[model samples]
Target: MEQTQSLVLVITTVETASDAGVLSRALVGLSLAACVQIDGPITSHYRWAGEVQQSSEFRLMIKSSLSAWPELRDQIAKLHPYDEPEIIMTFIDDSSEGYRNWVIDQTT
Candidate 1:
């Protein structure tokens, strides 16, 4: 069957493992995301509030369909602690056929 919606990988960073866990569960439980992989205590260096800041953060790699992007983004924005959080989406042009189908099945 031809796919109407493209798969995407959404990336975001959170302050702690607890926050990561919360986001991962919410997205998957709500069916906005098929899977969420959390990785880190990775170090981040960026400018915030007119100053350079450094911190340890956890990264959430969320898998979902482009069709679900809006709701997923909105939900993350609401639950995220940062006034402006990092929510970036990348289109998945290729993947294992079975895995791709699984993502479609889980999200829809």
Candidate 2:
């Protein structure tokens, strides 16, 4: 195995547990992401349609690489239920070497 490149942590929230599961499975099944951690029932307070809204949502921590970002984003956009899904990708500066390598290997 080669040295692992930088990875991305994409954070997103959805309205339902079922939506979370669907998104998670799609990402992993397509090898667009190595894994997706779903942490649920979190309250989300945000602005929508010029009004502050509060909702219960499931959060997904999607793990992928820069190389996979474009496709991953497209896939998420296509499948995400919301008109404007919150798929925010953050670069990981440091991570476990073994796990990072594993993520890269699994995805691409």
Candidate 3:
């Protein structure tokens, strides 16, 4: 049997909502992602430059096919403005069949 249900949710953050929009558009336009949802003016606190820092940010939740992970990741790096942007990926192994199929179709 062939495997037909593999997807990934890639999460990343940027300093501005405009940055989020730019990244989202690029990913989808390149067919590297099926969907990119931006959420926030959220606050994030983390250590950077050897000091604790807090900033307002927007979060990007990218839906992509498993096979597109490498390219999508590299694209994010190329477009991101931060010195060390946050790029976290999670496997989406279970979802409604219609949704899963739609994502795979769009990305592929």
Give the candidate number with the greatest TM-score. 1
Encode model 2's per-residue lDDT on 21-71: one tens digit a residue: 999999999999999999989999989999999999999999998788889
**Model 3 score (lDDT):** 0.90
Pairs in steric clash, model 1: none
Q: Which has the higher TM-score value, candidate number 2 or candidate number 3?
A: 3
lDDT of 3 by residue, 61-100 (tens): 9999888899899999998998888999999868888988
The estimated TM-scores of all candidates read 0.95, 0.93, 0.94
- Candidate 2 at 2: error in angstroms? 11
Q: Residue 98 deviation, candidate 2, in Å?
A: 0.7
The lDDT for every candidate, in the order shown, is 0.91, 0.90, 0.90
Predicted structure 3, TM vs. truth: 0.94
Q: What is the lDDT for 58 in model 3?
A: 99
Q: What tens digits encode model 1's per-residue C-alpha lDDT throughout 3-101?
A: 545799999999999999998999999999999999999999999999999999999999998788889999999989889999999989988888888
lDDT of 1: 0.91
Candidate 2 lDDT score at position 9: 92
- Candidate 2 runs further than 4 Å off: 1-4
On lDDT, the candidate that comes out on top is: 1
